[model samples]
Target: MGNSEATLRVDNVTKRFGDFTAVEGLSFDVRAGRVFGFLGPNGAGKTTTIRMIVGITAPDEGKIELFGERMSPKMQDRIGYLPEERGLYKKMKIVDQLRYFAALKDVPQSVADKRIDKWLERMNLAEWKNKKTTDLSKGMQQKIQFISTVLHDPDLLILDEPFSGLDPVNVEFMIDVMSEFKSQDKTIIFSTHLMETAERLCNDILLINKSKKVISGSLREVKASYGKNLIALRAVGGEAMLGDRSLVAKATEHSDEIEIELAENADPQALLKKLIESGANISKFEKVEPSLNDIFIDQIGGVK
Candidate 1:
């Protein structure tokens, strides 16, 4: 959490590809030093919105502002963008490629050199600095791309699926880096469909479906709005009772357990008593709030 001032604002923005509307009336704001989640499934126009924010394309309607002013060339360097797609010169050495990318942001040569090496060493890529990007693994290249994105130490970072191709370890490393940025009063706009990851990192989130804003708010507010109508149940031989619509609204299976949402006016005690009467071995049952995934299911009518 940080100041209430907005670092970026997308006001009533819309984009269309001819007759096909990609994004419509999308509006959200990222507060200073907060991780704002831009969440949606594939083809949800997340990329389109990102492109518009970064000035790769203009919104067909509405406007975007950064630091109280419209996006301009002079304001570009103040923000870092790590696009979902990989863009790197395969034949160029790691150090050279990073330096070149840094130069694009107008970072001085001396500063670029120090930042490049620091990032390389921090990510355990220093030994491979002389090697071409083609020689590194996909995971390594992704880290390099992230390094290049932050080399200029921009005030705002728009990371579009930054952890998409990374393994769990690398993903944590990226999360740590983003956390560090936040601690320094830098804001981040993280775009991803992984609700669990967003749950862990985001202070606020905007969930979209079919290019439309479905919900947007602080993570706590959104979850609290959905209420604590869920129960995480782990029981043997209770599967048959779960199908009773009078008690359960929905049940999505997770590994070795079931997340059950109670139907309107349904009693939690009744459901538990039914499981006990069924001679089931009940090990775990706890009332829990709806997860972001559960909320997404309600909004989008199913997983994408």
Candidate 2:
């Protein structure tokens, strides 16, 4: 899949509303069959960017290409978009809503019905198929929304905050669905504030801040690029040892561990030696990899 053409490409895209720029000079390529995470803080232009991708709005500058062609109405049926906001006709029956959505995408009623049955059953909403959408719990409603999104089996799925309002079990079910999509070679652009979820599902990520791209790369390379600057230490009295100006820049203490950020030029071995010398019962000392959450905060300049 390394040589597969990008499923979607945003080239030098920018969006301006009046005097404010929502997205500025953005560029990235999402490869086929890989789960891509689109992330940014609120008002950082993630929603605007998504709108442009879905053809809800046009970019003020540059261009977006999908399926190796310029983005257009004809290309939209190949993409399934689930917006961050929930919108359902509360008066509509659950199954009727699915049929209507499928019809909008040009799916025949018979085919839509079969696909709806399959998805509703898969989502454990088979029993609620005849119920009004307003009658279901928030979690059940979310499942219904999910069913509507995939009713036509679009090649690329854009999920914005897909796991919101789901219980733990439902969250797992959603994750499994995303993984299943991957197995079917369906590409996804997943957006969520759940850093751990993004880390688990996204093969690549594009992070934006202040309407600009901060970083974009494979997940492994992104984490590796941050380097092993964090240390996880478990020693009975070694918290005090983290105060050495030359070795430790900052330390966040947990009940049974200390997460130490190494000062520039500090050696992990030197920090361990100091902990031993301080008479602490050293149990563990190791270089820690920065997580997606860590990188997100660091890149956005939100870290203290």
Candidate 3:
């Protein structure tokens, strides 16, 4: 993320509906040219926050500024948004639908047509361009909706659960596509509960709980703050390979080995030596770092 380009700022934003407050004092900045992860469990106000940013729902209090200007109707054309729910008309042909959305954004026909074709090719949807959106499979339809969001070449993108139902292969495809968007210096704010994806893709992340930011920072910084070192050990021996569980702090058993969360004072070298001497036939014993899921559980607790 470049500090030079303007940022999208949400200053002390809050939203309410009658008796319920959907988002409260929510604030963050999506810096230009980076993928920012907006993460939380279900009903954590991620959607509400995104809705305000895209101007679909106004905040009850506070402000949203994009490119140093307050968000306004005209700024609609400057952003590309893919909501969590799919909304494209099933009857429209892909090309026609793309052109219609482009026109809605005030894109001229000649340029719209050319850009449509380019995006179709870039997404490998060129052959499906003439087919009706209804004719494609669920995953394929997802691909089309994704194209519709980016067709206008907007500077900022807001994606909600972009990989929800995608298979492993399609998920990989989406990651590759997102990587391309970042290369162009386009800002992307992705909302998802999938920790692994956020762990791999985001340059910065904001984790919310009960409509408040519980954690926000670079991935390295966040994980390092967890204060426990992860270690994975694999050996040929049975449970005895682990020795007395007392020697380790907390251990989780994998199919073939055990993963331990070493206490701060526990010496990893001593543990390794103990395991080797116990006739454990150690194949691998490596210290692992905490995953996003661990940190999430540590901060947000379990689902309600």
| TM-score for each candidate, following the candidate numbering | 0.82, 0.85, 0.82
lDDT of 3 by residue, 132-243 (tens): 9778888878888888898788889999999987789889988888888889898999988889889999988899988888888777888777647778888776456444
Among the numbered candidates, top TM-score falls to: 2
Tell me model 1's lDDT, rounded to 2 decimals: 0.91
Write one digit per residue (lDDT tens) for candidate 2, span 1-304. 4437798999999999999999999999998888999988888899999999989999999999998899998778888899999778999999888999999988899999999999988887899989997799989898888888888899889999999999999999898998898888888999989899999989999999889999899998999898868888887885677778899999988898888889988988988888898899978888888889988888887622
Indicate the worst ten consecutive residues by lDDT in candidate 1. 295-304
Per-residue C-alpha lDDT of model 1 across residues 1-304, encoded as one tens digit per residue: 3478999999999999999999999999889989999988788999999888888899999999999899777788988999998678989999999999999999999999999989999999999999998899999999999999999999999998899889999999999999999999899999887889999999999998898898999999999898858899998887899999999999999999999999998999999999999888999999898789889878888544
Off by over 4 Å in 1: 231-285, 302-304
Which stretches of candidate 2 lie above 4 Å from their native place?
Answer: 1-3, 233-282, 302-304
Whole-model lDDT, model 2: 0.89
- Candidate 3 regions off by >4 Å? 4-6, 230-285, 302-304
